[model samples]
Target: MKTTGKVWKYGDDVNTDVIFPGKYTYTIKDRAEMAKVALEDLDPEFTKSAKAGDIIVGGKNWGCGSSREQAVSCLKERGIGAIIAKGFARIYYRNCLNEGLPIIVSSEAVDAIEAGEEVTVDFDAGQIVTKKGTFPFPPYPEFVRGLIEDGGLIPHVKKSLGLS
Candidate 1:
């Protein structure tokens, strides 16, 4: 799979509350509405400007704090195609995969990328291409790639069972 988008850069230790405010966790159930508040506390302009397939580039400990799936969901709902970071919180990483939002770990790429620059992620080749250059990351296993392609775990399972 391949994804191309403009970058939305951020720094270290960005927690779940910033990704999607904890206060709205119980109130916002609609996906589109969830997107509206995404990064409101961290980057107020994000919800206003982000377009489908825009990429989020983050520094170390990205997605740290809490296991709120809404954090991942809000970004996914906002049409964020992928997240490239120096590192990720484990639960948040899992949450991204579960929600079909691609998360990548590449400190090199994160450092090289700038906000508003366009990038193309070639998942099949495991390369992140930027004007600075191309950086390599390990390719996802076929099963994992399949899960993302099918839109997370539930849809993948349903497809495997011929129920979708």
Candidate 2:
């Protein structure tokens, strides 16, 4: 699979609290509503400016706080094409995969990419290309790609079972 988009850069240690904010959890049950406040604490204009297929690039330890699934859900709901981070909190990484959000671990790309620059990620080829340069990384395993392609674990499992 491949995706191309303008980048949205963020710093290290972006926690779940900033991603979804615990304050709204109780009041917001709808994914689209939750997405409106996504990264609002960090970048108040994100919801207004970000578009479908835009990528998020971040520094090391991205997603380092709580394991709130909304962090992943919010990004998905907002139509983030993928996230490229120097590193990821283990739980958040798994959560992204579980929610069918494409996330790549690429310190090189994270360090090199600038916010608003156009980028292309080739998942099948494991490469990220930009005006600056091209960076290569390992591609996701087939099973994981299958999960994402099928729109997360539940759908993947259901497909495996011929349920949907």
Best prediction by lDDT: 1
So what's the TM-score on candidate 1? 0.94
Writing each residue's lDDT as its tens digit, candidate 1 over 1-164 gives 89999999999999999989889999999988999999999998897889999999999999899899999988998888899999999999888888999999999999899899999999889999998999999977788788888999889889989999
Q: What TM-scores do the predictions have?
A: 0.94, 0.94
Against the reference, the lDDT scores of all candidates come to 0.92, 0.89
- Clash numbers, per candidate: 0, 0
Model 1 regions more than 4 Å off:
160-162
lDDT (tens digit, per residue) of candidate 2 on 1-164: 89999999999988888888988878899999887888988888786788889999988888888888988898899999999999999999989999999999988888889989999999888899987899999978888888889999889889999999
Q: Tell how far residue 12 is off in model 2, in angstroms.
A: 0.9
